[model samples]
Target: MLSFPSRKHSSLRVALTALTTLAVAGGAAAIPTTSTATPNAAPKSWDETAYRGQVEVVRTPEGPADTEYLTGRVFVDQDRDSASDRRERGLDGVVVSNGRDVVTTDRHGRYRLPAYDNMTVFITQPAGYQVPVDESNVAQFHYNHLPEGSPELRYGGIAPTGPLPDAVNFPLVRSQLTRAQEQHCVIAGDLQTYDRTEVEYARQGAINDLAGRRDYQGCGTLFIGDVVGDDLSLYPDVKDLTSLTNGPARFLPGNHDLDFDSATAEHAFDTFRAQMAPAYYSYDVGDVHIVALNTVRYPCTPDVDNADGRRPECDDPENSPRYNGRLDENQLAWLEQDLAAVDDDKLVVVAGHIPLLTFADEGSAIHQVDQVREVYELLEGREAVSVAGHTHSIENMRTGDLVQGWQDLFGVEGLPFPHITAGAISGDWYSGELTENGYPVAVGRDGGRPGLLTLDIRGDSFRERYTVTGESDRVQTQLGINSPTYRDWYAERQAWNDNPEGAAPELGDPHVVIREDLAGQTWLTTNFWMGSTGSTVEVEIDGRRAGEATRTQEMRGEDQLIGPEWSDPHAVAQQLVHGGSVADRTMHLWRFELPADLGTGRHRAEVTATDAHGREYTDVLHFRVVDQP
Candidate 1:
């Protein structure tokens, strides 16, 4: 999800190029706008792009000159239309922002802050209210303010506004979506559609699955980024797919959805805002406050010696199209204020495309946030949890689960709250064989089956569950036996796959292991999709206690270990033979080292997974231990 371009262009040069192209096309670009009565005092260009960039209308405070402040009002839409009506009165206590600065509406429902250019002005959706959505089901909650439109860019970066507007008002419709404490929040990660074909795959897969389900109409489904694979034109296709959701659909920008050809970072996500969503925004439902952050920073300039020992001789960010995960100073400041306004008892659900810390990509500095500790500090003592995607793995990392990268890069040790990677719907970019439903079985990198994560919330507390595509909730564990024969087959398959001329490696009986294979090297592995710190996996051999299995990664600030020993044999056996990321090391794999004295007969290990919340699930696996053949 990088946007590092081959070359850099100056802002002026970018502007000139845009102007020339528009002139040649015989039309300056056009933006989409909805019809609204009782709109603000009209005077400027009606172009939706330019209109969206207009500064909030003038507000002459009874204060000083150097103290310029932004002004806005939040009103209840008496009529369901998006515009504010005269009969519609102001709604007090509604929070608004200029990216970093946060302010609440006064008694009259008006807010003011120091105004600035290139700032995204938005209103946080209050409890008992819902923001409007465009035809694509994208939430409408913010306005972009820029004096001049984007520099030379593809996907038509925002057109210039030239000046501030007379007034900027947000209208909220009374909705059941945000009024209750009980909620089902839908979280889908990494749609990552590459083209029309993949778009159809999404439709048949998660989209179709979502279509049949009538749940989550209130909390709605939020698609965390990597919405598309670098192609801005596919935005319409992306929207078409989103229409399948039974509830309101919203989006967050990912690195992949950037205008890489843009001249400045300011215009980087302009196309995303233009087509899919705001750079970032927030909304409220029940006791949970969802703060969606734009954590992707493009063209991330690295120091002379990058800390990534894994990738030495790395090219400069300017020379490569890499992106770093970071929250801008403004967003961070805004977050502090936003949190300050919220009651500590309220559950804060922070969502972003890139994770703050992950069991996957622990060594790469750019993959995780640079200021995770700061975010943690802002939410300190508050009941909170985070959701992210980008690693294409499902991880349910709970509090006290240490991330070594956080300690090394940000000096953070244990997770303050649960951090989950919702797992990508694209499922390894829609890799592997097509199912009868006309979709691929794109298993995830950590061997998690492609699925959507749902948060069943009551008050500030919640229970998280992952529902695999085309499967029921009971299918949570993936069972496999890690044996010498399988490991040998793994190595041999890799060697053959590396050569185009080599014959295909066949995976014989997957559940068969000989007595010789039972040396201390063999073990029973289980990839529990929703497994976390307090979770336990107990193995019973033919109804007897074989003892609790040890988790592969303790997540206690230790280094990550990968390879055959850490791999999910069940996932790899199929993923490698089909097509998908290898089921290598994962955060959820638990193994029970097989005893050397077991009998040489087909035996069953009953695994009972008990989560941190005490909910339990059972799964079984059968394997044979014949005499050495």
Candidate 2:
């Protein structure tokens, strides 16, 4: 995974000032001109899944007289109109881009870039300035420069621009909400609703949770990639879902949200750019500057050499149509410039679709960023953290948490900052049985419940919390046990569930255990969904102090210990039969050895989990130690 966003070949930052009345939705009238170039058309058949070079970049000849120069001004919109007027002062030092090369606005607040057939000219909404939002509350900060709209596109790609406008201007409104150091930024992972029906499920799930709340209206809600599942048409439904939020909604594209039919990597996210949001962008709210990135490179090159760890080469993109975590060069340069402008006192929050590194699937080369150290170096002295989706798991990796996978794959020693996998809102791709609220249980691979991540920011410091969909924040850990009966049920159910050849066998009372079972290798398990290396779990059985349970996956350069032994049996009880990803091995599982000498009776085990930050949460589970069969 690469830490930066995406890069396009087109971008210009020049300064010019022009006055014109803007239209609704922050769009402007076209500059009167006739194009002297032939039409630049999309191919009849373009394979977006192929490597970058495989697809051809088709362009038409631009006559010397037909050359287009894009003109735009960055002005302080005294009136929040979408256009620049005499009354508005052109803001100096604001950065703008033609999609690739970046430039700052001149004293006149005007910029001119060599316009391409298809490009998106946008500004890096400067700190203390707010951008305009359309009907769905998506920030309208860029001008789509497609002279002729998309061809053979599904999601109604950018509308055809008859000609290049005389100027494209940006508007900004000043707000105290964005100036405060304390900000509540909501980072929602993979709202990947495949169709209309799942869209409604989302409406009832996290969207419902956001509607009645009022915290994140300033820093806003960022849907960190996977906005849809291959269906570009569903972008509207995703937008409608965002309308429920009290804040502005932003988006990033994921592998599944790609325009796979597009011929080249440059236009792979065109439909998404047209419908959902920019491929990548940065905005600031209060003392926090958020750098939202697009990190998925589809149809990644596969490496067949390093099978089963004899170790050499690591470029597996998982066959055709799959993707890996990566970023192009342009974004990295823009990021450097963006960060250089910010004061050291400000907090930086970097978000992307794919994580730079994660505890789940730690050893998989494709699961973590290939350029994590570069990102770490970029933010060397700044207080920053990264949050991402795509793994369908929740991981709260703190600084200094080491895994051999990162060391081996990317030569990364340890994390430079907290790297959190936000645990997709489309948990397990919206799997499992439907809840009473009409949404799926969607338990994640690490057994994290479907939820949203909130970063409670105060100046440069922040606290992160996950609120499970349809459940309160208190639902942090899942309790389970391992015994002969549990293991037997686990094996039997997984088999029948996979094949479905017979009536599914029901698991007996999962929370209950017998003295005989305890004698025969019964162990209590606590799956602390967000637990990390420093976290601890302890148990008190029936008023007596039991020893502390040891955490699995010590995260110190060790290989994965998977299978039934490390599984969360409570999750397996449902997952083996349901549709979600199985919760087999977890980095946060704590196993307590059950005492073989316990008397035959009902016993209560009090479980306490202490997070890396010293915050403790407790829960109790009751199980019987009976003499029954």
Which ten-residue region of model 2 has the weakest summed lDDT? 23-32
Residue-by-residue lDDT tens digits, candidate 2, 1-629? 10122223222322322211111110011111222111122222112111111101113344233356666677776655465678888877766766665666777776656668877777777666767766676777777778777776566666785566656777776655567655778899988889898898889999999875666666778999888888888887887887666666888888888877654466678788877677887887876778888787655544422343422233443334455677766667667766765667667898998888877767776666666778888899777989999888888888877877788787888788888888888898988899999999888788777899888776667767777787655666778888888888778888887788868877778877866788788888888877887888888999996579988778777777788888888887778777778888777789998999888878888887777655676777888877885
- In candidate 1, stretches whose alpha carbon ends up further than 4 angstroms from where it belongs are 1-70, 303-315, 595-601
Model 1, 362-462: lDDT tens digits are 87777888778889888887789999999999999998888677677667778899999999889888998898988898888899878898887767777
Task: Tell me how many clashing residue pairs each candidate has.
Answer: 10, 13
**lDDT agreement of model 2 with the native:** 0.72
In model 1, the worst 10-residue window by lDDT is: 23-32
The deviation in Å at residue 61 for candidate 2 is 21
Clashing pairs in 1: 4-321, 14-152, 57-165, 57-166, 57-167, 69-113, 70-113, 100-330, 100-334, 149-160
After TM-score superposition, the amount by which residue 106's alpha carbon in candidate 2 deviates from its true location, in angstroms, is 4.0
Model 2 misplacement above 4 A: 1-69, 112-114, 301-321
